[model samples]
Target: MTDLASFPELLAGYFEIPIDEPGAKAVSDPYGSVRVDVGVIRQEVRSPGYLVSGLVYDVSTGLVESVVAPTQVPTG
Candidate 1:
């Protein structure tokens, strides 16, 4: 995992699903209440809305598989 020590420059943003609570099981989750990891934990002051190039990680894993980039369009 990359060091988030620099912040903003290292880890720009984060976002997540609106589950009932953190670590809430998805079994009871509604359709739109699900989202991937790295919820907007930080933001870049300089870039405004641009997510810092590469600053994300999965806490729910011992080894991450992939990162699903946010899309302007939602999936069906």
Candidate 2:
């Protein structure tokens, strides 16, 4: 909730999720617990907005594979 803004790199990677098996999962990091899925993000993306932020996970084990944050984004 409050810490959702901590990881932007992993979230950005989801932007490249294959169009077929976009995954969904809950991750616990410095930002607390979050429910995320590239599929959902793809379905509901609002550009000109803040970059995404969260951790990625394995669809089967729910193990965090990586942390993602935009790190930096073009402001134009």
Candidate 3:
């Protein structure tokens, strides 16, 4: 089973294509597909680490939603 805790990292990596390649549009997984909107990625700094968040437009529902919580990586 896929651990729920790893979803943030999984989603963060899944968005890599669209983030790197400007021409990229959509992506797919076992659940479904979503249109990547690189502009929505948000980042913020916290005390012990930083958080990066992003959202995707669902192809089926046509609604934007967060696939995972902001990924938090400790700096120390």
Candidate 4:
């Protein structure tokens, strides 16, 4: 497995964004959630929107356990 510290660089490369351009935005899970740094790399869109994807790293374990993608929600 790759080092958790390198996730930001990996994400930057995957998204074709500059590593030094503040590409990765840090996020967090709900309260009582596991300790992890959630880095979101939003999908670039022409208009304003919320579509995004990211990686989850376990802070205690120093490992990346999963990649997350946006899920569709039914609209009324």
Residue 43 CA error for candidate 4 (Å)? 11
Candidate 4 per-residue lDDT, tens place, 1-76, comes to 2433346666566546677632233212322122222222222233344444444667788987545555332222
Q: What is the Å distance of residue 15 in model 3 from its true position?
A: 12
- Model 3 alpha-carbon drift over 4 Å, by segment: 1-27, 30-49
Using TM-score as the measure, the top candidate is 3
- lDDT per residue for candidate 1 within 1-76, as digits (tens), equals 1243233322223223343233332222222122322233222133344442222244666554334344333222
* Whole-model Cα lDDT of every candidate shown, in order: 0.31, 0.44, 0.43, 0.41
Question: What is the overall TM-score of model 2 with all chains considered together?
Answer: 0.25
List pairs with backbone clashes in candidate 1: 14-39, 14-40, 14-41, 15-38, 15-39, 15-40
Model 1 per-residue lDDT at 50: 43
Range of the 10 consecutive residues with the lowest summed lDDT in candidate 4: 31-40
Q: Sort the candidates on lDDT, descending order.
A: 2, 3, 4, 1
Off by over 4 Å in 4: 1-5, 22-24, 27-76
Over all chains combined, what TM-score does candidate 1 have? 0.19
Off by over 4 Å in 1: 1-20, 25-37, 42-46, 52-64, 70-76
Superposed by TM-score, candidate 3 places the C-alpha of residue 68 at a distance from the truth, in angstroms, of: 1.1
lDDT of 4 at 19: 74
Of models 1 and 2, which has the larger TM-score?
2
Clashing pairs in model 2, backbone N/Cα/C closer than 3 A: 8-68, 8-69, 8-70, 9-68, 9-69, 9-70, 10-68, 10-69
Residue range with the least summed lDDT across 10 consecutive positions in model 1:
25-34
Worst 10 residues of 3 by lDDT: 30-39
